[model samples]
Target chain A: MQFKYDLEGGNFSRAGHASSEVKKILKQLNVDARIIKRIVVALYEGEVNVVAHAHKGVVMVDIDEKRIYIRIEDEGPGIPDINLAMQEGFSTASASVREMGFGAGMGLPNIKKNTDQLNIESEVGKGTVLEMTTMISS
Target chain B: MKISEIVDVLNARVVCGSDKLNTEVRYAFASDLMSDVLTLDTENLMLVTGLANLQVIRTAEMADIFCVVFVRDKKATPEMKKIAEENNIVILESPYSMFRAVSVLHDCGLQPVY
Candidate 1:
C-alpha cells in the first residue's frame, strides 16, 4: 500500500499529518509496535524537515510485507553540505522554528537513527529527496 | 505517578482522553524539542511542554507517551485536541509554567528519563 501527502512549506500546523496517518494505518495493519514507532519517527522527522526548509514537498509512503519505504521530495534551498547537515547540532532553521520546539539540528540525525536505511540527495539550489526504509522482521 | 495526580498538581484542564487519567506514568520528560523527545527511549512517560501543536500529540503517540501537559496556559487548537483524542493520549492545559510544572511533578516523585 502507498500513501501520499503534500507538505506545505512553513506550515507548522499541518506538519505531522502524514506521519500520524501512517501510524494509524500501521496500527490497523497490526504491525509490530517497535516497527511502527520507527516508521513514525523517521517519517515525522522528514516531514518536519521539509516544512522547515523546503518551499513545498510531497511525502510518499510505500508499505510492503517486509519493509516500509518513505520518500520525501522537497523543492527548497537544498543542503549545501550533506555531511554537515547530517551532524546532530547543525541546523539553519530560523528562530521562529526553534520557538515552536523544532530546528534543534537533530532532525536528520533522528531520522537516520530511527530507520534501517536512509539516502539523501540534494543540490544547493534545486531540491532534496530523502528515501528511507525500515525492514519488518518476521 | 497516576496521570490524574499530575493533572491535579499542575492544576490543568483535561482537554481529551480523560479516561486515561488512571494511566501510570513511570518517568517524565519535559522538552519543547520534539526531536529530543523522539530520541529518548521512554515508555509510559509524561511529556510537559509549552509547544502546542498537532505534532506534539503525534510525537507522544509515536513515543508511547501516556500523557501531555501544556504548560504556561498554552491552549491547543480544536484540531490538536481532536488528534489527541484519536491517539488516545491524555491532554492537559495548565497555567503553571514549564519550570513550575516540572518541579511539581518532580517533587511528587516523577523523575526524568535519563
Candidate 2:
C-alpha cells in the first residue's frame, strides 16, 4: 500500500500530524508494535525537520509485507554539509524554532538511529529529500 | 506507578484525560527537548517536560508515552489538551521543577528512562 501526506513549513501545531496518521494506519494493519514505534519516531523527526527548515514538504510511504519505506521531500534551503548535519548537537534552525524545544540537532541523528536504512540527498540552494525504511516484521 | 500517584506526588493537576489517571507507567523521562525524549527505547513511559506546546503531546503520542507532566506550572493550551484527550494521553500540570519532579518520581519507585 502507498500513502502520502503534505507538510506545511513553520506550522508547529501540525508538525506531527502526518506521523500520527501513519501510526494509526500501522496499528490498524497490526504491524509489530516495535516496528511501529520505530517508524513513528523517524517519521515524526523527519516531519519536524521539514517544518523547521523547508517551505513545504511531502511524506510518501510504501508498505509491503516485510518493510515500510518513507520518503520526505521538502522545498527550501538544503543542507550544505550532510556530514555536519548528521552530527548530533549541530543545527541551523532559527531562534523561533529552537524556542519550541526542537533544533537541538537530534532530529536527523534520531531518525538515523531508529531506521534500518536512511538516505539523504540535497542541494544547497534547492531542497532536500530524506528516504528511510524500517522492517515491519515482529 | 499509577498516574494518580504521580499527580499526588508532584502536586499536579490533570488537564485532560482525567479518566486515565489510573494508567500504569513503568518509567519516567524529564526533558525540555523533544529530541532527547524521542531516543528513548521503551514504552509505557511518562514524559515530564516544561514544554507547553502541541509538539510535546505529539512527541508523547509518537513515543507511545502514556502521560505528560508539565513541570514548573507550565500549562498546555486548550487545543493541546483536546489532542491529548483524543489520543488517550493524560496531560498533567505540575508545580515542581523538572529536576524535583524526576527525583520525587524516582524516589517513589518509578525508574528513569535511561
Candidate 3:
C-alpha cells in the first residue's frame, strides 16, 4: 500500500498529521511493534523537519510484505552542508522554535538511527529529498 | 506503577484516559524536548513534560509511551485530548512543578528509563 500527505512549513500545529496516519496504517497491517516504532520515530522527525525548515513538503509511504519506504521532498532553503546538518548538536533553529520543544538538532541523526536505509539529496537554493526504507518482514 | 497511584501521589487531574488509570507503566522520563523523547526505546513508559501541544501527544504515540504527565499545571487542548483518546494513551495534568513531581514519582518507586 502507498499513501501521500502534504505538509505546510511553520505549521507546528499540524506537524505530525502524516506520521500519525501512517502509524495507523502500520497498526492495521499488524506490523511488528519494534519496526513500527522505528518508522514512526523516523517519520515523525522528518515531518517535524519539514514543518520547521521547509517552505512545504510531501511525504510518500510505500509498504509491502517485506519493506516500508518513505520519501520526503521539501521546498525550502536546502542544507548547504548535509554533513554539518547531520551533526548531533548542530542547529539553525531560532529560540522560539526551540521553546516549542523542537529544533534541538537531533532530527537527522535520529532518522538515520531508526531507518534501515537513508539517502539525502539537496540543492542550496532549491529543496531536499529524503528516501528512507525499513525492512518489515524477514 | 499503576497510573492511578500517580494521580494520588502527584495530585494530578486526569485530563483524559480516566478508564486507563489502571494501566501500569514501568519507566518515567521527563523532558520538554520531543526529539529526546523520540529516542526512547522502551515499553510501558511514562513521559513527564511541560510541553502541552499536539506534538507532545504525537511524540508519545510514535515512541509508544503509555502515559504522559504534564507538569506545572499544564493541560492538554481539546484536539490533543481527542487524539490521546483515540490512541489509548493516558494524559495527566499535575499541579506540581516538573522537578517536584518527578522527584515524588521517583520516591514512589517509579523507575527511570536511564
Candidate 4:
C-alpha cells in the first residue's frame, strides 16, 4: 500500500497529521506494535522537519510485506553540511519555532535512530530529500 | 499509577478524555521539548510538559503516550483538546512546575522513563 500527504512550512498545527494517519493505516494492517512505534517516531520527526524548515514538502509512504519505505522531499534551504545537521545539538530553527517546544536539534537523530535505513541528500540553497526504511516484521 | 491518581497528586484539572482517567501508566517523563519526548522508548509513560501547543498532544499520540500533564498551570487550547479526544489520550493541567510535577509523581510511585 502507498500513501501521500503534503506538508506546509511553519505549520505547527498540522505537523503530525500525516504521521497519525499513517499510524492508523499501519494498525489496520496489523503491523507489529513495536514496528509501528518505530515508524511513527521516525515519520513524525521527518514530518516535523519539513514543517519547521521547508517552503513545502511531500511525504510518500510505501508499505509491503517486507518493509515500509518513506520518502520526504522538501523545497527549503537545504542543509549546508549533512554531517553537521546529523549531529545531536545542531539546528537552524528560528526562535519562534523553538518557543513552541521544538527545534532542539534532536529531530534528525531521532529519525535515524528509529529507522533501520536512512538516506539524506541535500543541496545548499535548493532543497532536501530524505528516504527512510524499516522492516515491517521483527 | 492510574491517571486519576496522578490528577489527585498533582491537583490537576482534566481538560478532556475523562473516560481514560482509570488507565494505568507505569512511567512519567517531563519535558518542554517535543523532540526530547520522541526519543523515549518506555511503554505506558505519561508526559508532563509546560507546552500547551498542538504538537504536545500530537507527540503524545504518536508515542502512544496515553496522558499528558501540563505543568506550570499551562492549559491546552480547545483545538488541542479536540485532537486528544479523537486519539483517546487524556489531558491534564497542573499548577505545579515541571520539577515539582515530576518530583510529586515520582514520589507517588511513578517510575522515570529513563
Residue clash pairs of candidate 1: none
Scanning candidate 4 chain A in windows of ten residues, the lowest lDDT window is: A93-102
Candidate 1, DockQ score (0 to 1) = 0.70
Off by over 4 Å in 2: none
What are the per-residue Cα lDDT tens digits for candidate 1 across A49-73?
9988999999998998888889999
Model 4 interface RMSD over true interface Cα atoms: 0.7
Q: Which runs of model 1 end up more than 4 angstroms from their true locations?
A: none
Isolated chain A TM-score, each model = 0.97, 0.97, 0.98, 0.97
Q: All candidates: CA RMSD in angstroms?
A: 1.4, 1.2, 0.8, 1.1
**Tens-place lDDT digits, model 2, residues A1-138:** 999999999999889999999999999999988888999999999999999999999999999889999999999999999999999999999989988889999999999999999999999878999999998984
The better-scoring model by TM-score among 2 and 4 is 4
Better of 1 and 3 by lDDT: 3
Error of 3 at A62 (Å): 1.2
DockQ of each: 0.70, 0.89, 0.84, 0.90
lDDT of 4 by residue, A1-138 (tens): 899999999898999999999999999989987789999989999988988899999999999988999999999999999999999989999998888788999999999999999999998778899999999975
Task: Give the docking tier of candidate 2.
Answer: high
lDDT of 3 at A93: 86
